[model samples]
Structures are given as structure tokens and as C-alpha cells.
Target chain A: MAQLFYAADLFGVAVFAITGALMAGRKSMDLFGVLVIAIITALGGGTLRDVILGNHPVSWIRDDTYILVASIAAVGTVVWVRLTQPIHEKGLLIADAFGLAVFTVYGTEVALQHELQLSTAVIMGVITGVAGGVMRDIICNEIPLIFKKEIYATACIAGALVFIALRALATPPWLDTGVAMLTVLATRLAAIRWHFSLPRFHLLDRD
Target chain B: MAQLFYAADLFGVAVFAITGALMAGRKSMDLFGVLVIAIITALGGGTLRDVILGNHPVSWIRDDTYILVASIAAVGTVVWVRLTQPIHEKGLLIADAFGLAVFTVYGTEVALQHELQLSTAVIMGVITGVAGGVMRDIICNEIPLIFKKEIYATACIAGALVFIALRALATPPWLDTGVAMLTVLATRLAAIRWHFSLPRFHLLDRD
Candidate 1:
């Protein structure tokens, strides 16, 4: 029997893909480049998780639905971008936060299933969720925000811990996912609102 | 006894890490960010291989030298970047290509050791060699050249195929490694010099 979690995950994946496509449209990339970014934004996290756990067939490759959903969303986003003129830079950050939150919960849930410890699951959650964004930034020849002394990845980690806590309290799975996503979103929003940042810790002297 | 091939691999890894640090330095990333990029660039390919193969103690985690070498290189690169302002972008690309060639041959060798078929070995080689750059580019928030109708990955595939053919002809092990590395370097250099690009395949309809 298919569960509600699966449905939310599909929604998350679609939105992430759309966000990626919209972002790519800001550049002069061809359709394939847009598609590649879209796929990375949507499915890259789960791919990392599966690879880490040594799972077979890969998550998206196992069921074609993920790819199908992302492709459709990508095409839709491309159309939307062209019609809307240009994607707003500020709005893009908000959508990216949503993607990170949803993916963090899903990643943690998957890691727990793999018998990884709660701490490891939480780490994996943040890593899988934000790592795609990190990768996306790197490919674009920009230093990732995570390393830019931003409070970005910390929100994902905090949210993941919230998810684990709720699950431990016997919270319904839906509530857990929602709470986790909200935690991430709220933390991220607050960070942006207050310009939250992690203090730089430089081990070596830099002139 | 560790052979010349082994020594070359170490040298290539350190060089790759230095190149990665140089790329990160372009953005004035803090020391940690520079170090992280360099280390990831150096270890990313081999780590993917070990994870996919379910090899215990993922490559860098097994040998302290990989980490030490990459770290030293990263530190050196950062220092150089500080001493010399505004590195040439082309220099980084050439260094990256050199690293890619080395890793492609080594990746295929590892796959062969795992008794994988030629096609699988070639695919693995390409993945190991190019995924790091793809990951780096994504984190930098740029459209990866990998998906940009480029001949970068194609060169790796061609070089891998050459290695397989030579090995099948009973070439000596060290000779095979040397031949493969040289072939990869030459092919990549040619592609870069000639501005070689793959045929653009567009599956998306224009809006």
C-alpha cells in the first residue's frame, strides 16, 4: 500500500526540479544542461544516500516515476521561466530552502531505515539535502554557500534533529515530516531575516 | 613494492587537490572552504568507486596518505594563491585535465581488478574521472561543462577503451598504465586545444 509520505516526497521532488530548471533558465544553458541541473536538484540527494548505503538499482533508477516527475517539472518550469521573463533571485532562495527541508526529512528517514544511528541519520539528512545545492553551486563555478560562512546547512541539521526527536515521541509520521520541514523552513527563514551566519573558524593563518 | 604507476597516482592526486584549491581560491573562500574543495576533488572519485563496490573503509579512510597529500597540496595552493594574486583560469583547467587523465586510467584499473567487464569498467572510469569536476561545478553554482555538450567525458571513454584493448593484447601492467595515461592526456589535450564539443542533443521542445 502506498503511503502519504511517498506522495509528499513526490511533491518535494517535483518542486525541487522546477526550482532547478527555473534557476538554470537564468543562464544560457541548453535544454540538456537545464535537464541535468533539474535532475541533480531533484534526485541527487537520494542518489548519494543510496550509494552510501550500497543500495541497489539507485532510488530514481529503480522506479522511473522520479525521473518522469522531474522531467515534467523541468519542462513546465522552463515554460514558466520564459513566460515570466526572468526568475527572481530572492524568490529562488526561498524555494531552495523548501527543497532542502523536505529532502532533509526524507534523507533522515531513509538513513534510519538503513540502520544508521540517529546522529549519522541526522548528518546524512543535512548532507544529502544540501549537498546537491553545494554540488550545483560548484558546477556553476561558485563557492557553495555552506562554505561561505552561511547558516544554510546548519538549518538542515537542526531540522533533522527535530525530526528524530518527534519520531522518538511516537509522533505520527506525517507530523514528523511536517515538523521537520517546518523546522528547517523556520530556521532558514529566521536566518535570512536576521542574516544569521556561522562564525568563520580558520585553523590556519591567512594573510 | 609500490611501482612507478603508484607513485604517479599519488603525484596526480596532490596536483589535482592543488588545482581544486586554486579554483576555490578564485572566490576568496576561507581556508576551510579551500581545503574542503581540494580534498573532495582529490578523494571524490576513489570514494565513489569504493562506495559503489561496497569496499570497506572507503579509499581515503583506508590510507592516511591520500588525506595527508591532498591536505598538504591544498595548504600549499592556498599559500601560493595568497602570494600570487589572481591565478589564470586556464591554468586550473589544464591541471584539472591532467588529474582527470590520471584518475581515468587508475579508475579503469581498479574496475578491472574487481573483474568488471570492459563496458562497465569504462563507465566506471568516466564516472570516477568526471564526477569530481561535475560535483565541483555544481557546488560552485554553475552549469557543469559535463552536461554542456562537451567532449570532456568522451575523451575519458576513448582513453579507457584504448587501455582495455592494450591490456587484452597482453601489454605489461606498468606499460598498460603508462600507455593509458599518455593516451588520456593526449586525447584530453587535443580536445581542449581544438575546442572539441559533442553534438548537441535537445530533447526538450522550445517554448
Candidate 2:
């Protein structure tokens, strides 16, 4: 892989690590739990991608650098949050949005590299992006964001489409990746910012 | 792959479908819930196996036979229980044992065919065997079987070792699969029946 690709992968890992740490902070979990979530969030999506694609040594086991970086980032986030600007619940959401975008793009690229079909790659990307968070939430005894919200997978889906479009339009792969990343980030953030909600199925009571 | 393979898969589906339908029955749910769980239990493990393996068209989606058999069995079991026997919780442990064993063997074979090393193949098998139940329990707001007492993954690990050992001993592949299956079933059933528990640990608490 190019140095640029490696940089992007590491960047995504750091972003997710911080994001998981931030979520752990919100729950007021101990430092260990904070670190655990951070490690899981950073490693989770890529691990899924590798396992699904039958990539051996699994990705983290192959490189191990990613886990190292995530650990440092997670520990740093916790210390930084404690020492510097106090973090609020809303702050965690912002970090989470960034984390979500990174994983979605990262996962899509991994799937494409493995030569999955366009649609399957897209679906797998979304699954990789969301499944980890779903797991994090389940472990924490919270409802998964994907199952509860309107726009969770929607953002990943849109970003994946953009990715494919860019590729088809003969754009440079890196540029396409950037566009996909930004599109997901913007869509997800905008949805939350505007309090946008999709139609909900309602129930009627019998008299 | 083989006639016996298909039969084992079908048996796994049928048993688990009945198990799922029976659980939903205890919930006094509508027929929809019963059918959904039945399908989930019957199809869930293989669906996950294919997804993780990146095998397209999933198992049931490819052949359609598994789904049909599972649905018929599910409906049949629910009706039979409603008309005849009481819904005994005793059957759940037995059904779970059967499903776990069958899916584990099936997953191991699929991963091995994909040329994964024995360790990765075994991990895939265990994950495939357990993940569906974890998913089902999560959706139903129950703690996952993976987190429950009674040596779940340990049982699978042991059976997978038996499979590997037998194969290494030049046991006919078919016979190896049978031994593995029976080992898983026996181990899991014995664990449940004897109320066996693995020692739990929390790293923080340990210190």
C-alpha cells in the first residue's frame, strides 16, 4: 500500500479510538472500560472486513501497529479529556460522526480491494461501519444506533454510492475516497443537527 | 456438499426452527414472531457464516431448500405443541446443542474449502455456531448464550479440536465430521444438564 493509504488507515484508527473513548467517558466507565471500547471501536470494523474477506492473520494480528496506535490514542483521549476542555454528551456525538464516516470509507475500500461486487461491497461497508457500534451499544446495554435512528445506515449507503460513482466517473481513487468520507460526515452531522427524523410506525389502541 | 451434509444442515434447521417457534410461543406472540424466530434460528447461523465468509447469495438464499424445510418444521412444531405437549423449557437446551453442533461443523467445512488454515477455520466455525443465537437473544432483550453459563464456546472449541484431531489421524472426512458433531452435542448437552459453569473474570475485579 502507498504511504498515503497507510496514513489514511492510521488516521481512521485514531479517529475511532478517540470516538470510543469519548463514548466511554459519557458513560462514566472506568479507565479500563474506556480503553476497551477504544480498542474495540478502532479494531472492530477492519477486523470484520478482514474476517469476512478471509484475510488471514486478521488485519490487526497481521500489522499490530493499528492496535498500538489505537491504544495510545485512547489513553491520550481519556487523559486529554480529563485535563483539558471538559467533554459533554454532544461532543461525543460529533466525534462519533467522524468515526462513523472513517470506518464506512475504510470498510468500503477494503471490500473493493477484495473484489466484492459493487452492491455487496456497499452493503458490507455499511455493515462494517455499523456493526461495531451496534456491538458497543449492546455491550453497554443501550439500543444500537442503527436500529433506533433514521439515518445511520443511510449515511453509509449514500457514501458508498458516492464512492462507486466517483470510481465509475474515473475520478482518482483517493479523491473518490475523500468525497465519500466527507459526504458521509456531512450527511450524518446534518441529520443530527437538524433533528431530522424519518417516518415512524405508530400504533393504535383499541377501545 | 454430501448427502449427509445436507441432512445434517436440514436437521439443524428443523430443530432450531422448532426451538425458536417454541420460544416465541412462550412469549405468546403472534404467528409472525414465531415464524420470524424460526427463520432466524434456522437461517441465522448460516446467513452469518456466509456474510462473514463473503459467500454470496447466503446459504438459504442460494438453494431455497433450507428455508422451506425450516419453515415447514417451524409451523409444524408450533402447531403440534399447541395441540399436544406443553411448551417445556427443557427442549431449548437440547435444540441449542443440536444447532450449535451442526452449524459448527458446517462452518468449519465451508471455511476449510475456502482454504483458511485450521485455526481460522475453527474460529469461523465457533463464531458461526454462536453468533446467530447471540443475535436472536439480543433482539429479544435477553442476554446472549455466549455470555451465559455452561461453557458454550468451550464446548465448540473442544469439538473443533476433536474434528481437527480426527482429520489428522486420517479419519475419513465424513466420520471426522460425525465425531465432531456428536462431540459438540454431547459436550453442550452435558454442560447444560449438569449446570456446568466456567469461571468468570473481570480484569479489574481480579486485581
Candidate 2 lands at a TM-score of 0.63
lDDT for each residue of candidate 2 in A109-156, tens digit (9 for 90 to 100): 777778889988898778667776766678556677776554778899
Q: Candidate 2 DockQ score?
A: 0.06
**What lDDT does the true structure give each of the candidates?**
0.75, 0.75
- Return model 2's CA RMSD, one decimal: 7.6
- All candidates: TM-score of chain A: 0.91, 0.90
DockQ (C-alpha based) per candidate is: 0.11, 0.06
* TM-score of model number 1: 0.58
The clash tally of candidate 2 reads: 0
Scored against the true structure, residue B65 in model 1 reaches a CA lDDT of: 72
